[model samples]
Target: MDAPTGEQLSIRNRDAHAVVTTIGATLRAYEVDGVAYLETFGADEAAPMGSGAVLVPWPNRVAGAVWTHAGERHRLEVTEPARGNASHGLVRREPWTVTAHDADSVSLAVVVEGREGWPFSFRATITYALGDRGLTVTHGLHNLGDHPMPFGVGTHPYPRPGHADPDDCVLRLAATTHLPLDPESMVPTGGPVPITGHDFAAGTPLRDVDLDDAFGGCVPGPDGLVRHSLRGPRGGVELWADPVFGWVQVFTPHAFPGRAGRAVAIEPMTCPPDALNSGIDLLELAPACTWTAAWGLTPLA
Candidate 1:
Protein backbone atom coordinates (compact mmCIF):
# COMPACT_ATOMS: atom_id res chain seq x y z
CA MET A 1 0.00 0.00 0.00
CA ASP A 2 1.11 3.55 -0.69
CA ALA A 3 2.14 5.71 2.21
CA PRO A 4 -0.15 8.46 3.46
CA THR A 5 0.56 12.00 2.23
CA GLY A 6 1.27 15.40 3.84
CA GLU A 7 2.07 16.34 7.41
CA GLN A 8 0.65 14.74 10.55
CA LEU A 9 -0.14 17.38 13.17
CA SER A 10 -0.65 16.56 16.83
CA ILE A 11 -2.34 18.81 19.33
CA ARG A 12 -2.80 18.14 23.02
CA ASN A 13 -4.13 19.80 26.12
CA ARG A 14 -4.57 18.54 29.67
CA ASP A 15 -7.67 16.56 28.67
CA ALA A 16 -7.00 14.88 25.33
CA HIS A 17 -4.71 14.50 22.31
CA ALA A 18 -5.56 14.41 18.63
CA VAL A 19 -3.74 13.43 15.43
CA VAL A 20 -4.65 15.40 12.33
CA THR A 21 -3.41 14.67 8.82
CA THR A 22 -2.88 17.34 6.17
CA ILE A 23 -4.28 15.05 3.52
CA GLY A 24 -8.00 15.83 3.50
CA ALA A 25 -7.44 17.70 6.77
CA THR A 26 -8.65 14.55 8.48
CA LEU A 27 -8.66 13.58 12.14
CA ARG A 28 -6.66 10.37 12.12
CA ALA A 29 -6.97 9.56 15.79
CA TYR A 30 -8.27 11.18 18.99
CA GLU A 31 -7.84 9.70 22.40
CA VAL A 32 -7.88 10.35 26.11
CA ASP A 33 -4.98 8.58 27.77
CA GLY A 34 -4.45 5.49 25.49
CA VAL A 35 -8.06 4.71 24.68
CA ALA A 36 -9.38 6.02 21.37
CA TYR A 37 -12.65 7.96 21.23
CA LEU A 38 -12.67 8.34 17.46
CA GLU A 39 -12.33 5.37 15.13
CA THR A 40 -8.82 5.10 13.69
CA PHE A 41 -6.87 3.19 11.04
CA GLY A 42 -3.20 2.49 10.42
CA ALA A 43 -1.04 5.57 9.94
CA ASP A 44 0.15 4.38 6.52
CA GLU A 45 -3.35 3.58 5.34
CA ALA A 46 -5.70 6.03 3.67
CA ALA A 47 -8.69 7.45 5.52
CA PRO A 48 -10.93 4.41 5.82
CA MET A 49 -14.40 5.04 4.38
CA GLY A 50 -14.13 8.80 4.76
CA SER A 51 -13.54 8.48 8.47
CA GLY A 52 -12.75 11.91 9.96
CA ALA A 53 -13.05 13.57 6.52
CA VAL A 54 -14.27 17.12 6.11
CA LEU A 55 -16.99 17.35 3.48
CA VAL A 56 -17.44 20.76 1.96
CA PRO A 57 -19.51 22.72 -0.62
CA TRP A 58 -21.80 19.71 -0.35
CA PRO A 59 -21.93 16.84 2.09
CA ASN A 60 -23.84 13.86 0.74
CA ARG A 61 -24.78 12.45 -2.65
CA VAL A 62 -25.92 14.54 -5.60
CA ALA A 63 -28.37 12.76 -7.83
CA GLY A 64 -27.36 12.21 -11.47
CA ALA A 65 -24.11 13.97 -10.63
CA VAL A 66 -25.56 17.25 -11.86
CA TRP A 67 -26.84 20.61 -10.56
CA THR A 68 -27.86 23.99 -11.89
CA HIS A 69 -26.97 27.45 -10.64
CA ALA A 70 -27.56 30.85 -12.26
CA GLY A 71 -29.24 29.11 -15.21
CA GLU A 72 -26.09 27.04 -15.78
CA ARG A 73 -26.14 23.28 -15.35
CA HIS A 74 -22.92 21.76 -14.04
CA ARG A 75 -22.02 18.10 -14.28
CA LEU A 76 -19.83 16.90 -11.44
CA GLU A 77 -17.53 13.91 -11.71
CA VAL A 78 -19.40 10.88 -10.50
CA THR A 79 -17.45 9.76 -7.44
CA GLU A 80 -20.07 7.22 -6.38
CA PRO A 81 -20.11 5.19 -9.56
CA ALA A 82 -22.20 2.36 -8.24
CA ARG A 83 -25.03 4.69 -7.29
CA GLY A 84 -24.69 6.81 -10.44
CA ASN A 85 -24.16 9.97 -8.41
CA ALA A 86 -21.53 12.25 -6.98
CA SER A 87 -20.60 11.33 -3.43
CA HIS A 88 -19.46 13.84 -0.83
CA GLY A 89 -17.58 16.84 -2.18
CA LEU A 90 -14.21 17.58 -3.78
CA VAL A 91 -12.20 18.34 -0.61
CA ARG A 92 -12.39 15.05 1.27
CA ARG A 93 -9.31 13.51 -0.36
CA GLU A 94 -7.36 16.67 -1.27
CA PRO A 95 -4.29 18.03 0.46
CA TRP A 96 -4.28 21.12 2.64
CA THR A 97 -1.58 23.62 3.68
CA VAL A 98 -0.70 24.57 7.22
CA THR A 99 -1.55 28.18 7.96
CA ALA A 100 -0.66 28.33 11.64
CA HIS A 101 -0.01 26.04 14.57
CA ASP A 102 0.15 26.22 18.35
CA ALA A 103 0.50 23.76 21.18
CA ASP A 104 -3.20 22.98 21.43
CA SER A 105 -4.52 23.70 17.95
CA VAL A 106 -3.47 23.58 14.28
CA SER A 107 -5.05 25.41 11.39
CA LEU A 108 -4.90 24.23 7.78
CA ALA A 109 -6.35 25.66 4.61
CA VAL A 110 -7.25 24.44 1.11
CA VAL A 111 -8.64 26.04 -2.02
CA VAL A 112 -11.12 24.71 -4.54
CA GLU A 113 -10.44 26.17 -7.96
CA GLY A 114 -12.75 26.56 -10.90
CA ARG A 115 -13.29 23.39 -12.91
CA GLU A 116 -15.65 21.80 -15.43
CA GLY A 117 -18.12 20.57 -12.87
CA TRP A 118 -17.55 23.24 -10.26
CA PRO A 119 -16.71 26.57 -11.86
CA PHE A 120 -16.40 28.58 -8.68
CA SER A 121 -13.36 29.19 -6.53
CA PHE A 122 -13.25 29.24 -2.75
CA ARG A 123 -10.91 28.85 0.20
CA ALA A 124 -11.56 26.90 3.38
CA THR A 125 -9.81 26.41 6.69
CA ILE A 126 -10.09 23.72 9.33
CA THR A 127 -8.76 24.08 12.84
CA TYR A 128 -8.52 21.25 15.32
CA ALA A 129 -8.23 22.35 18.93
CA LEU A 130 -7.87 20.42 22.15
CA GLY A 131 -9.55 21.65 25.31
CA ASP A 132 -11.27 20.53 28.50
CA ARG A 133 -14.36 19.76 26.43
CA GLY A 134 -12.31 17.16 24.55
CA LEU A 135 -11.75 18.34 20.94
CA THR A 136 -13.34 21.24 19.10
CA VAL A 137 -13.12 21.47 15.30
CA THR A 138 -13.91 24.67 13.49
CA HIS A 139 -14.40 25.05 9.72
CA GLY A 140 -14.39 28.34 7.85
CA LEU A 141 -15.07 29.08 4.18
CA HIS A 142 -14.71 32.15 2.00
CA ASN A 143 -16.03 32.74 -1.47
CA LEU A 144 -13.21 33.93 -3.73
CA GLY A 145 -15.27 34.13 -6.87
CA ASP A 146 -17.11 37.30 -7.90
CA HIS A 147 -20.56 35.70 -7.82
CA PRO A 148 -22.81 34.14 -5.27
CA MET A 149 -22.46 30.40 -4.68
CA PRO A 150 -24.42 27.62 -3.11
CA PHE A 151 -22.57 25.75 -0.38
CA GLY A 152 -22.80 23.28 2.48
CA VAL A 153 -20.45 21.68 4.99
CA GLY A 154 -20.12 18.54 7.09
CA THR A 155 -17.62 16.25 8.84
CA HIS A 156 -17.39 12.47 9.16
CA PRO A 157 -16.18 11.31 12.58
CA TYR A 158 -16.76 7.78 13.74
CA PRO A 159 -17.10 7.72 17.53
CA ARG A 160 -16.13 4.55 19.36
CA PRO A 161 -16.74 4.34 23.11
CA GLY A 162 -13.18 3.62 24.13
CA HIS A 163 -12.80 0.17 22.52
CA ALA A 164 -16.36 -0.88 23.28
CA ASP A 165 -18.26 -2.98 20.76
CA PRO A 166 -20.65 -0.79 18.77
CA ASP A 167 -23.29 -3.49 19.04
CA ASP A 168 -23.60 -2.86 22.77
CA CYS A 169 -23.65 0.92 22.65
CA VAL A 170 -26.68 3.09 23.17
CA LEU A 171 -27.20 5.91 20.67
CA ARG A 172 -29.26 9.01 21.15
CA LEU A 173 -30.10 12.02 19.01
CA ALA A 174 -32.00 15.27 19.51
CA ALA A 175 -33.52 14.99 16.05
CA THR A 176 -37.27 14.77 15.56
CA THR A 177 -37.44 13.77 11.88
CA HIS A 178 -35.48 11.41 9.64
CA LEU A 179 -34.93 11.40 5.91
CA PRO A 180 -35.86 8.21 4.12
CA LEU A 181 -33.70 7.24 1.16
CA ASP A 182 -34.34 5.38 -2.05
CA PRO A 183 -32.92 1.89 -1.89
CA GLU A 184 -31.14 2.11 -5.25
CA SER A 185 -29.69 5.61 -5.38
CA MET A 186 -29.42 6.08 -1.61
CA VAL A 187 -30.76 9.59 -2.06
CA PRO A 188 -33.59 11.22 -0.20
CA THR A 189 -36.90 10.18 -1.75
CA GLY A 190 -39.24 12.91 -0.57
CA GLY A 191 -39.41 15.02 2.59
CA PRO A 192 -38.55 14.33 6.20
CA VAL A 193 -40.51 11.54 7.85
CA PRO A 194 -41.43 10.82 11.45
CA ILE A 195 -38.68 9.13 13.40
CA THR A 196 -39.14 5.54 14.60
CA GLY A 197 -37.19 2.73 16.34
CA HIS A 198 -35.57 2.74 19.80
CA ASP A 199 -37.15 6.16 20.26
CA PHE A 200 -34.25 8.12 18.79
CA ALA A 201 -35.73 11.23 20.39
CA ALA A 202 -34.93 9.54 23.66
CA GLY A 203 -32.23 6.82 23.52
CA THR A 204 -31.75 3.62 21.59
CA PRO A 205 -29.47 0.65 21.70
CA LEU A 206 -27.47 -0.58 18.71
CA ARG A 207 -28.62 -4.13 19.16
CA ASP A 208 -29.70 -5.55 15.79
CA VAL A 209 -30.36 -2.04 14.47
CA ASP A 210 -29.00 -1.08 11.08
CA LEU A 211 -29.00 2.55 10.01
CA ASP A 212 -27.67 4.63 7.12
CA ASP A 213 -30.11 7.48 7.42
CA ALA A 214 -30.01 11.28 7.51
CA PHE A 215 -32.00 13.05 10.20
CA GLY A 216 -33.24 16.66 10.47
CA GLY A 217 -35.13 18.99 12.82
CA CYS A 218 -32.42 18.71 15.42
CA VAL A 219 -33.39 20.36 18.68
CA PRO A 220 -30.44 22.23 20.01
CA GLY A 221 -29.94 22.45 23.74
CA PRO A 222 -29.92 25.56 25.92
CA ASP A 223 -26.25 25.88 25.16
CA GLY A 224 -27.15 26.45 21.51
CA LEU A 225 -25.58 23.22 20.29
CA VAL A 226 -27.14 20.02 19.05
CA ARG A 227 -25.85 16.89 20.70
CA HIS A 228 -25.62 13.17 20.02
CA SER A 229 -24.10 10.51 22.23
CA LEU A 230 -22.96 6.91 22.30
CA ARG A 231 -22.92 5.23 25.69
CA GLY A 232 -21.22 1.96 26.51
CA PRO A 233 -20.97 -0.04 29.72
CA ARG A 234 -18.08 1.93 31.14
CA GLY A 235 -18.52 5.43 29.73
CA GLY A 236 -19.76 7.43 26.73
CA VAL A 237 -18.88 10.18 24.26
CA GLU A 238 -20.98 13.05 22.96
CA LEU A 239 -20.83 14.88 19.66
CA TRP A 240 -21.99 18.48 19.52
CA ALA A 241 -22.41 21.00 16.73
CA ASP A 242 -23.46 24.61 16.30
CA PRO A 243 -27.01 25.46 15.37
CA VAL A 244 -25.91 26.14 11.79
CA PHE A 245 -25.59 22.40 11.43
CA GLY A 246 -29.25 21.50 11.37
CA TRP A 247 -28.89 18.00 9.99
CA VAL A 248 -27.10 14.87 11.15
CA GLN A 249 -26.33 11.78 9.11
CA VAL A 250 -26.16 8.55 11.12
CA PHE A 251 -24.47 5.60 9.47
CA THR A 252 -23.71 2.22 10.99
CA PRO A 253 -21.62 -0.01 8.79
CA HIS A 254 -21.77 -3.75 9.32
CA ALA A 255 -17.99 -4.04 9.29
CA PHE A 256 -15.16 -1.59 8.78
CA PRO A 257 -11.64 -2.48 7.78
CA GLY A 258 -9.34 -3.24 10.76
CA ARG A 259 -12.50 -3.33 12.92
CA ALA A 260 -15.53 -5.56 12.71
CA GLY A 261 -19.13 -5.43 13.96
CA ARG A 262 -21.04 -2.12 13.77
CA ALA A 263 -19.11 1.14 13.48
CA VAL A 264 -21.05 4.39 13.85
CA ALA A 265 -20.42 7.57 11.86
CA ILE A 266 -22.36 10.57 13.20
CA GLU A 267 -22.01 13.30 10.61
CA PRO A 268 -23.00 16.89 11.39
CA MET A 269 -24.29 18.49 8.22
CA THR A 270 -25.40 21.98 7.26
CA CYS A 271 -27.63 20.44 4.64
CA PRO A 272 -29.01 17.06 3.73
CA PRO A 273 -28.10 14.82 0.78
CA ASP A 274 -28.75 16.15 -2.76
CA ALA A 275 -29.38 19.62 -1.34
CA LEU A 276 -27.71 20.97 -4.45
CA ASN A 277 -30.66 19.68 -6.43
CA SER A 278 -33.41 20.09 -3.84
CA GLY A 279 -32.36 23.59 -2.72
CA ILE A 280 -33.22 22.54 0.82
CA ASP A 281 -31.25 24.36 3.52
CA LEU A 282 -28.67 25.28 0.87
CA LEU A 283 -26.48 28.24 1.80
CA GLU A 284 -25.74 31.04 -0.62
CA LEU A 285 -22.55 32.96 -0.05
CA ALA A 286 -22.23 36.37 -1.61
CA PRO A 287 -19.02 37.65 -3.11
CA ALA A 288 -16.27 37.99 -0.49
CA CYS A 289 -18.54 36.50 2.15
CA THR A 290 -17.30 33.97 4.67
CA TRP A 291 -19.10 31.39 6.78
CA THR A 292 -18.04 29.23 9.67
CA ALA A 293 -19.33 26.21 11.59
CA ALA A 294 -18.23 24.47 14.78
CA TRP A 295 -18.48 20.95 16.14
CA GLY A 296 -16.78 18.96 18.87
CA LEU A 297 -16.59 15.79 20.91
CA THR A 298 -16.79 15.48 24.71
CA PRO A 299 -16.01 12.52 26.90
CA LEU A 300 -18.64 11.46 29.41
CA ALA A 301 -17.22 9.52 32.29
Candidate 2:
Protein backbone atom coordinates (compact mmCIF):
# COMPACT_ATOMS: atom_id res chain seq x y z
CA MET A 1 0.00 0.00 0.00
CA ASP A 2 1.09 3.54 -0.59
CA ALA A 3 2.18 5.76 2.30
CA PRO A 4 -0.85 7.46 3.88
CA THR A 5 0.92 10.81 3.53
CA GLY A 6 1.72 10.28 -0.15
CA GLU A 7 5.34 10.57 -1.31
CA GLN A 8 7.84 10.76 1.53
CA LEU A 9 10.83 12.80 0.42
CA SER A 10 14.05 12.71 2.41
CA ILE A 11 16.76 15.34 2.70
CA ARG A 12 19.92 15.55 4.72
CA ASN A 13 23.06 17.56 5.30
CA ARG A 14 25.74 15.66 7.16
CA ASP A 15 24.31 15.05 10.64
CA ALA A 16 20.99 16.79 9.95
CA HIS A 17 18.09 14.95 8.30
CA ALA A 18 14.41 15.66 7.50
CA VAL A 19 11.45 14.14 5.69
CA VAL A 20 8.88 16.19 3.83
CA THR A 21 5.62 14.66 2.67
CA THR A 22 3.78 15.58 -0.50
CA ILE A 23 0.43 15.77 1.24
CA GLY A 24 0.07 19.16 2.93
CA ALA A 25 3.79 19.60 2.30
CA THR A 26 4.13 18.44 5.89
CA LEU A 27 7.41 18.26 7.78
CA ARG A 28 7.11 14.62 8.68
CA ALA A 29 10.41 14.20 10.44
CA TYR A 30 13.49 16.21 11.44
CA GLU A 31 16.55 15.22 13.40
CA VAL A 32 20.21 16.04 13.92
CA ASP A 33 22.95 13.72 15.01
CA GLY A 34 20.34 10.96 15.55
CA VAL A 35 18.50 13.08 18.14
CA ALA A 36 14.91 13.71 17.16
CA TYR A 37 13.93 17.36 17.48
CA LEU A 38 10.33 16.76 16.42
CA GLU A 39 7.72 14.30 17.63
CA THR A 40 7.46 11.91 14.68
CA PHE A 41 4.82 9.40 13.72
CA GLY A 42 4.96 6.30 11.55
CA ALA A 43 5.03 6.71 7.77
CA ASP A 44 1.93 4.52 7.58
CA GLU A 45 -0.06 6.70 9.97
CA ALA A 46 -1.73 9.94 8.98
CA ALA A 47 -0.79 13.21 10.65
CA PRO A 48 -2.50 13.39 14.01
CA MET A 49 -3.75 16.67 15.52
CA GLY A 50 -2.41 18.74 12.65
CA SER A 51 1.14 17.54 13.10
CA GLY A 52 3.61 19.44 10.93
CA ALA A 53 0.77 20.71 8.72
CA VAL A 54 1.09 23.98 6.89
CA LEU A 55 -1.60 26.64 7.45
CA VAL A 56 -2.15 29.07 4.63
CA PRO A 57 -4.55 31.89 3.76
CA TRP A 58 -5.34 31.79 7.49
CA PRO A 59 -4.42 30.01 10.66
CA ASN A 60 -6.40 28.96 13.70
CA ARG A 61 -10.17 29.61 13.54
CA VAL A 62 -12.59 31.77 11.55
CA ALA A 63 -15.57 32.70 13.63
CA GLY A 64 -18.81 31.07 12.37
CA ALA A 65 -16.96 30.03 9.22
CA VAL A 66 -18.06 33.27 7.59
CA TRP A 67 -16.26 36.45 6.61
CA THR A 68 -17.11 39.44 4.45
CA HIS A 69 -14.73 40.70 1.80
CA ALA A 70 -15.49 43.74 -0.32
CA GLY A 71 -19.14 43.64 0.79
CA GLU A 72 -19.65 39.98 -0.18
CA ARG A 73 -20.00 37.42 2.56
CA HIS A 74 -18.00 34.25 2.09
CA ARG A 75 -19.01 31.19 4.06
CA LEU A 76 -16.31 28.61 4.39
CA GLU A 77 -16.95 25.00 5.23
CA VAL A 78 -17.07 24.59 8.98
CA THR A 79 -14.17 22.22 9.48
CA GLU A 80 -14.37 22.54 13.24
CA PRO A 81 -18.09 21.95 13.61
CA ALA A 82 -17.70 21.22 17.28
CA ARG A 83 -16.64 24.81 17.86
CA GLY A 84 -18.82 26.31 15.13
CA ASN A 85 -15.71 27.73 13.50
CA ALA A 86 -13.49 27.11 10.51
CA SER A 87 -10.25 25.58 11.66
CA HIS A 88 -6.92 25.97 9.96
CA GLY A 89 -7.09 26.87 6.28
CA LEU A 90 -7.92 25.40 2.88
CA VAL A 91 -4.84 23.37 1.85
CA ARG A 92 -3.66 20.99 4.55
CA ARG A 93 -5.07 17.78 3.09
CA GLU A 94 -4.54 18.73 -0.53
CA PRO A 95 -1.83 17.14 -2.58
CA TRP A 96 1.28 19.08 -3.53
CA THR A 97 3.68 18.43 -6.38
CA VAL A 98 7.40 18.21 -5.89
CA THR A 99 9.09 21.12 -7.60
CA ALA A 100 12.71 20.65 -6.58
CA HIS A 101 14.83 18.25 -4.57
CA ASP A 102 18.44 17.64 -3.63
CA ALA A 103 20.52 15.99 -0.94
CA ASP A 104 19.75 18.64 1.64
CA SER A 105 16.52 20.24 0.49
CA VAL A 106 13.15 19.77 -1.27
CA SER A 107 10.40 22.06 -2.52
CA LEU A 108 6.69 21.34 -2.98
CA ALA A 109 4.00 23.47 -4.58
CA VAL A 110 0.20 23.42 -4.54
CA VAL A 111 -2.17 25.51 -6.59
CA VAL A 112 -5.25 26.43 -4.57
CA GLU A 113 -8.08 26.83 -7.01
CA GLY A 114 -10.92 29.23 -6.39
CA ARG A 115 -13.50 27.48 -4.31
CA GLU A 116 -16.98 28.25 -2.96
CA GLY A 117 -15.86 29.97 0.22
CA TRP A 118 -12.40 31.17 -0.75
CA PRO A 119 -13.05 32.77 -4.12
CA PHE A 120 -9.42 33.27 -4.88
CA SER A 121 -6.61 31.55 -6.72
CA PHE A 122 -3.05 31.25 -5.51
CA ARG A 123 0.01 29.06 -5.65
CA ALA A 124 1.68 28.14 -2.35
CA THR A 125 5.13 26.67 -2.21
CA ILE A 126 7.05 25.27 0.75
CA THR A 127 10.72 24.48 0.81
CA TYR A 128 12.57 22.54 3.51
CA ALA A 129 16.34 22.73 3.76
CA LEU A 130 18.72 21.12 6.22
CA GLY A 131 22.19 22.36 7.01
CA ASP A 132 24.63 22.67 9.90
CA ARG A 133 22.12 25.11 11.41
CA GLY A 134 19.28 22.58 11.30
CA LEU A 135 16.03 22.86 9.27
CA THR A 136 14.77 26.03 7.66
CA VAL A 137 11.32 26.21 6.07
CA THR A 138 10.33 28.86 3.57
CA HIS A 139 6.77 29.60 2.45
CA GLY A 140 6.07 31.38 -0.80
CA LEU A 141 2.71 32.45 -2.17
CA HIS A 142 1.70 34.07 -5.45
CA ASN A 143 -1.71 35.54 -6.09
CA LEU A 144 -2.90 34.06 -9.36
CA GLY A 145 -6.17 35.91 -9.47
CA ASP A 146 -6.81 39.32 -10.98
CA HIS A 147 -7.91 41.05 -7.80
CA PRO A 148 -5.92 41.50 -4.62
CA MET A 149 -5.98 38.73 -2.04
CA PRO A 150 -5.57 38.80 1.72
CA PHE A 151 -4.06 35.93 3.62
CA GLY A 152 -1.91 34.71 6.51
CA VAL A 153 0.47 31.81 6.94
CA GLY A 154 1.35 29.51 9.80
CA THR A 155 2.72 26.04 10.57
CA HIS A 156 2.24 23.37 13.24
CA PRO A 157 5.64 22.07 14.27
CA TYR A 158 5.94 20.11 17.53
CA PRO A 159 9.51 20.52 18.70
CA ARG A 160 10.56 18.10 21.40
CA PRO A 161 13.20 18.16 24.15
CA GLY A 162 15.54 15.63 22.65
CA HIS A 163 15.48 12.39 24.65
CA ALA A 164 14.25 13.96 27.86
CA ASP A 165 10.76 13.66 29.22
CA PRO A 166 8.59 16.45 27.84
CA ASP A 167 7.35 17.41 31.30
CA ASP A 168 10.88 18.09 32.40
CA CYS A 169 11.46 20.58 29.61
CA VAL A 170 11.26 24.35 29.93
CA LEU A 171 9.33 26.42 27.42
CA ARG A 172 10.06 30.01 26.52
CA LEU A 173 8.59 32.54 24.07
CA ALA A 174 9.21 36.13 23.07
CA ALA A 175 5.60 37.32 23.26
CA THR A 176 4.37 39.88 25.79
CA THR A 177 0.66 39.95 25.01
CA HIS A 178 -2.02 37.29 25.06
CA LEU A 179 -5.13 36.88 22.94
CA PRO A 180 -8.11 35.74 24.95
CA LEU A 181 -10.43 33.16 23.38
CA ASP A 182 -13.96 32.03 24.14
CA PRO A 183 -13.97 28.66 25.76
CA GLU A 184 -16.76 27.29 23.61
CA SER A 185 -16.12 28.77 20.18
CA MET A 186 -12.36 28.91 20.61
CA VAL A 187 -12.36 32.29 18.87
CA PRO A 188 -10.75 35.41 20.14
CA THR A 189 -13.03 37.23 22.55
CA GLY A 190 -11.14 40.46 22.80
CA GLY A 191 -7.96 42.20 21.82
CA PRO A 192 -4.53 41.39 23.19
CA VAL A 193 -3.75 42.04 26.84
CA PRO A 194 -0.62 42.19 28.91
CA ILE A 195 0.26 38.59 29.65
CA THR A 196 0.33 37.40 33.23
CA GLY A 197 0.77 33.95 34.71
CA HIS A 198 0.59 32.18 31.35
CA ASP A 199 3.55 34.09 30.04
CA PHE A 200 6.46 31.98 28.92
CA ALA A 201 8.75 34.87 28.19
CA ALA A 202 11.28 33.76 30.80
CA GLY A 203 10.93 30.02 30.27
CA THR A 204 8.52 27.85 32.28
CA PRO A 205 8.52 24.17 32.94
CA LEU A 206 6.03 22.19 30.88
CA ARG A 207 4.79 20.04 33.77
CA ASP A 208 3.18 23.02 35.49
CA VAL A 209 1.26 24.34 32.55
CA ASP A 210 -1.71 23.41 30.38
CA LEU A 211 -2.09 25.76 27.50
CA ASP A 212 -3.88 26.21 24.17
CA ASP A 213 -3.28 29.87 23.91
CA ALA A 214 -2.28 32.45 21.30
CA PHE A 215 0.18 35.22 22.01
CA GLY A 216 0.93 38.44 20.18
CA GLY A 217 3.27 41.40 20.61
CA CYS A 218 6.24 39.24 19.82
CA VAL A 219 9.48 41.10 20.42
CA PRO A 220 12.36 40.37 18.14
CA GLY A 221 15.82 40.10 19.57
CA PRO A 222 18.83 42.09 18.39
CA ASP A 223 19.03 39.69 15.46
CA GLY A 224 15.47 40.77 14.47
CA LEU A 225 14.12 37.29 14.88
CA VAL A 226 11.40 36.06 17.26
CA ARG A 227 12.58 32.95 19.08
CA HIS A 228 10.91 30.30 21.22
CA SER A 229 12.34 27.16 22.70
CA LEU A 230 11.99 23.94 24.68
CA ARG A 231 14.96 23.06 26.82
CA GLY A 232 15.74 19.87 28.73
CA PRO A 233 18.56 18.63 30.86
CA ARG A 234 20.28 16.99 27.91
CA GLY A 235 19.80 19.55 25.16
CA GLY A 236 17.10 21.67 23.55
CA VAL A 237 15.52 23.02 20.35
CA GLU A 238 14.95 26.60 19.34
CA LEU A 239 12.30 27.84 16.90
CA TRP A 240 12.99 31.13 15.25
CA ALA A 241 10.78 33.02 12.83
CA ASP A 242 10.81 36.23 10.86
CA PRO A 243 9.15 39.29 12.36
CA VAL A 244 6.30 38.87 9.88
CA PHE A 245 5.10 36.05 12.08
CA GLY A 246 3.60 38.34 14.66
CA TRP A 247 1.63 35.77 16.57
CA VAL A 248 2.45 32.45 18.19
CA GLN A 249 0.14 29.66 19.29
CA VAL A 250 1.26 27.26 21.95
CA PHE A 251 -0.58 23.98 22.55
CA THR A 252 0.27 21.30 25.06
CA PRO A 253 -1.53 17.97 24.90
CA HIS A 254 -0.95 15.11 27.21
CA ALA A 255 -1.56 12.41 24.65
CA PHE A 256 0.33 12.06 21.38
CA PRO A 257 1.05 9.18 19.11
CA GLY A 258 4.34 7.36 19.90
CA ARG A 259 4.86 9.41 23.04
CA ALA A 260 3.95 8.78 26.66
CA GLY A 261 4.08 12.34 28.04
CA ARG A 262 2.81 15.73 27.00
CA ALA A 263 3.82 17.29 23.68
CA VAL A 264 4.11 20.97 22.87
CA ALA A 265 3.47 22.64 19.53
CA ILE A 266 5.01 26.05 18.96
CA GLU A 267 3.22 27.48 15.95
CA PRO A 268 4.52 30.63 14.35
CA MET A 269 1.71 32.51 12.69
CA THR A 270 1.68 35.60 10.49
CA CYS A 271 -1.57 36.62 12.18
CA PRO A 272 -3.86 35.66 14.99
CA PRO A 273 -6.96 33.48 14.81
CA ASP A 274 -9.91 34.84 12.78
CA ALA A 275 -7.76 37.37 11.01
CA LEU A 276 -9.82 36.64 7.93
CA ASN A 277 -12.59 38.71 9.48
CA SER A 278 -10.74 40.98 11.91
CA GLY A 279 -8.10 41.88 9.27
CA ILE A 280 -5.41 41.89 11.93
CA ASP A 281 -1.99 41.62 10.32
CA LEU A 282 -3.35 40.05 7.13
CA LEU A 283 -1.09 40.38 4.09
CA GLU A 284 -2.64 41.60 0.88
CA LEU A 285 -0.97 40.57 -2.34
CA ALA A 286 -1.70 42.38 -5.57
CA PRO A 287 -2.18 40.56 -8.81
CA ALA A 288 1.01 38.98 -10.12
CA CYS A 289 2.69 39.64 -6.81
CA THR A 290 4.41 37.04 -4.69
CA TRP A 291 5.24 37.03 -0.97
CA THR A 292 7.59 34.91 1.03
CA ALA A 293 8.51 34.29 4.69
CA ALA A 294 10.67 31.87 6.61
CA TRP A 295 11.04 30.14 9.99
CA GLY A 296 13.32 27.42 11.28
CA LEU A 297 14.38 25.03 14.03
CA THR A 298 17.89 24.78 15.43
CA PRO A 299 19.12 22.14 17.85
CA LEU A 300 20.79 23.76 20.82
CA ALA A 301 23.68 22.21 22.66
| TM-score for each of the candidates | 0.97, 0.98
| Runs off by more than 4 Å, candidate 1 | none
- Candidate 2, residues 1-301: lDDT per residue as tens digits? 9788999999989988899899899999999889999989989989999999999889999999999999999999889988888889988998999999999999999999867699999999999999766899999999999999999999999998788777888999999899999978989998889999865887888887899999998999999999999988988899999999989999999999988888899999999999998898888999999999999999988
How far off is residue 233 in model 2, in Å? 1.0
Error of 1 at 205 (Å): 0.7
lDDT by residue (174-240, candidate 1, tens digit) is 8888888998999989988888765986789988888889999999999899999999887788999
Residue 52 of model 2 has an lDDT of 96
RMSD list, candidates in order: 1.3, 0.9
Instruction: Highest lDDT: give the candidate number.
Output: 2
Worst 10 residues of 1 by lDDT: 1-10
Sliding window of 10 residues with minimal summed lDDT for model 2: 197-206
